[model samples]
Target: MLVNSYGLNGMGIEAIKLFDKMPRELIFEETYVCVLNACSHSGLVDHARSIFFNIINKTEKIYTTMVDCLSRAFLFEEAQILINNFELHHSPSPTMLMSLLSGARNKKDNHLSEKIYIRIEEKFPKHKNRLVSASILLSNAHASVGDIEKSLNIKNKLYQLGLKKKIGLSFTEINGQIFKFRAHDRSHPRSKDIYAENDKISNELIEHGHQFDSAWITRLLDEDETIASVLSGHSERLAIAWNFVANPNTKQIQITKNLRICGDCHQVTKLIAAIRQCEIIVRDANRIHHFYTNGQCSCQDYF
Candidate 1:
């Protein structure tokens, strides 16, 4: 539990220290998974690889974790090779493929995402849930790279099949209370102040030469929405805005999101931490991000 907590809090070194102090005889397959996950979350791929190769009896879960580490580093080729090697001794695992697909989506590597999706379809034809999830990632990969036509096509297909994309949400705590938000949410009593603060942040970011990259947006903007308006409405941004509104003097803010942080939001958070002279910690679906006051992130922009 300590190992996982340390990793999730961007303390990979501490997690590794704890792992090293553990008696080898007490180590189990799950132990390796936790440590490897720690490495993955903290961008310690080299350490993860060293630990992984030393394991004499590697389980499928162990292999998946290592693949996740490499994939998070954008080492797609290495990740795929590892997956291939895993299949040499056992059947293909949907989890490994999904990890690769998710990495591709994050990196906006549409080509690799397509190839992985094809492989997933061929290898796991009977796995309906996996297929739907793969399609979502594939579509997101396309949208991330500005291939909106392909993205729309996939979305249309999913809609026709009665499948829907999961709604993204974010949670944050301020003043001993928890606040939850969705994109463009205005249901809160302090909605006016939240949106006002968000607008203020956006204007400040623009003055800092932070261009709102429309590519990070996965869907078409509504008639009343501009790129800044759409991106600013992201659940994380709303949550962060709420923090400042509820506690104007907050020096530290923590957020938990249901989806991976988009590239634009990642960059924005780093800048916000620096500009606002605060510490921002975000735990996204994939990993944790610690944005320090110097505009540096613990993930080193790997995520």
Candidate 2:
């Protein structure tokens, strides 16, 4: 738990220190995985590699974690090689391929995305659930690069197959009470104030020279929707807006998201932390991000 907490807070070095201090007899497979995850989240790829190679008994989970570390660093060739070597002795794991695909999506590498999707299809044809996730990642990779037609095609195929995507949601706690929000949610009693706060923050962001990037938009904007409008409605943004409405003088905001935070929301959160001179910690599906007051994230832009 300590190692995971350190990783969650982007304190990889501290996590490593604890791992080293642990008694030799006490170290287990999970211990290695935790440390590798810490290194992955904190961008300590070299450290992760060293630790990974030294392990005497490498498990599928360990290889997946190492693959994730390399993938997050955009070392596609190295990651692929690791996956290939793993498959030599063991069957392929969907989790491993998904890690590489996710990294390709983050980099918007269309070619790599297609290649990885093909591999996934060839290996996991019968695995409907994993295929759904792979398709989503592949579609997102295309959408991120303005290939909306391809993205829509993937989505349409999923719909035709009757496979549903998971909905994104964010949760926050204030005054000992937890609140949940979805994209464009208006169910909260203080919905008006929350949106107004978001608008105010959006204007401040613009003043700070933050332009909403349309590349992050995955679909066509409605007549009433601008890039800013759609982005401001993201679940995490709504959660942040609620934080401000619930407490105007808040100095710290923490949120938990059910999905990976999108690129736009990640950028906006960094700017918001700087603009408000507050600390913002978001625990997304992949990892935790600590947004500091200087417009920097704990992940160091790796995410």
Candidate 3:
């Protein structure tokens, strides 16, 4: 009724107010979760905190939801403190732990990352999911710090545990057309045309004083000669190749990926954005990284 009569903004405020008027003892875990989600959407940090504390007498699921909301908002330290002080016997759910680690990674807080890993180990030593999460975090943090060998070693350990990282891929929809590509994928029907276009764009960018940083490519390939070719096969490149083929003059491209964007890929995308005179929005595991012609990314290289 409120939405039909007053509209979205008014209805939302009215709904929240109505929920807030409920007696404290009557408020339930699901109610708290809903309020936490509202806080996340509306950026109501103080309200979220109040609701979180009020829900303390409720359930662990409510606490988990609060942790997730805080982490998603980049309040890693606060989330950590809340989780630690709760004295919950078991640690945060693996999903919550993953969110915390993701938030820390976004902030490039390796110290926090290490603490999270140690906590996970202590709390859930036999949990394979936590182990995989820790491995991925360590590998990514090591790679970010330029310790490529250590990063690869961490990945190798994960593999030994029978938990290899999923190959990252991306897909983009432009002008009602969908294009997909995986890391080093060459199975697309338009692979030949895509390569030809990528070659042309890469050459033009090089001529315009842009250098392709193929560090991730080098890490993936066993042979030195395959590095350049492999990098060209990355998902971002595939998206760009499709963009060129479908809409050569488009000013913006949006791509979504299933995993964290590699450091080298991040740098390369920024260069590509500048060279192509376009803005690229990449949604990865954590958040959106927007690249523009100013040779900068939205994350400031934190991820």
Candidate 4:
């Protein structure tokens, strides 16, 4: 069955309308997946929950998608309650478990995360590959709360398994050409210029009272210099600086990230948008943030 593009692209209400018009017999797993995905990405918690319970037939993905929607909306208690209620009869899928884990990460509840890790670890034998990725997430969640020991243990386990965490990378298009950047990468010919621009942005933003979020710093550097280096070498920041160098007055810049945008990157993007008078849109794994020149973001800092 053909899935609705609108739904897949975050137009949840429009997708729901079309879903309602589809022939009941034609609606299947993909249809539900499309609508639920749109609702989740767009943070339509009510719509997602309503359709979840009222739909004709549901799949495992539908449940997981609803959890993702509620989590993205910051309804952690509600999401947990829903998962508990569902678990009364059915075992949760890996995706469903990860949705709950995402909620734990967002809330920064290290205790809850430890418990969640237990559940996740119990399923390790069956989902070794997926859990390898989830382990990095668990590690980050722990590290975000300053539980560096557990975080390192998780990463060390992945190392023993010969699995390496994929480095964060971001891409942007300028003058119709794509530019890619990774953290601490200085391979670009204009690497010095990008670092200089990032340094300027960091100092200015710091002067403006933007607090440094050191969680984004994955490098082992002197604590005093780590914040500056992290900010300078961030993939999205590098991409943004490159965009400015290539077209100083570009109205907007778009960057796509392979992982979630960190708190520091989010903070810098807002300030940079205002400072440069350029709208910036960054799409990460979980959501899209539209930073306007006024230093306000479309996600309202929820992400």
Best by TM-score: 2
- Count of backbone collisions in candidate 2: 0
The lDDT of model 1 is 0.88
If both were scored by lDDT, which would come out higher, candidate 3 or candidate 4? Answer: 4
Candidate 1 lands at a TM-score of 0.73
- Per-residue lDDT tens digits of candidate 3, residues 51-139? 67765475777777777778767888799887776556754566567668766765666667777877777777788866886767765
Q: TM-scores of all models?
A: 0.73, 0.76, 0.58, 0.69
RMSD of each: 5.5, 5.1, 8.6, 6.6
Regions of candidate 3 where Cα sits further than 4 Å from its true position: 1-28, 89-92, 168-180, 187-189, 195-303
Worst 10 residues of 3 by lDDT: 1-10
What local distance difference test score does each model get?
0.88, 0.90, 0.72, 0.77
Which residues of candidate 1, in runs, are more than 4 Å off?
A: 1-27, 30-51, 125-129, 170-180, 187-192, 205-215, 252-267, 270-274, 277-303
Clash pairs of candidate 2? none
| lDDT sort, best first | 2, 1, 4, 3
Off by over 4 Å in 2: 1-26, 169-180, 186-192, 206-216, 251-263, 270-274, 277-303
Per-structure clash totals for the candidates: 0, 0, 0, 0
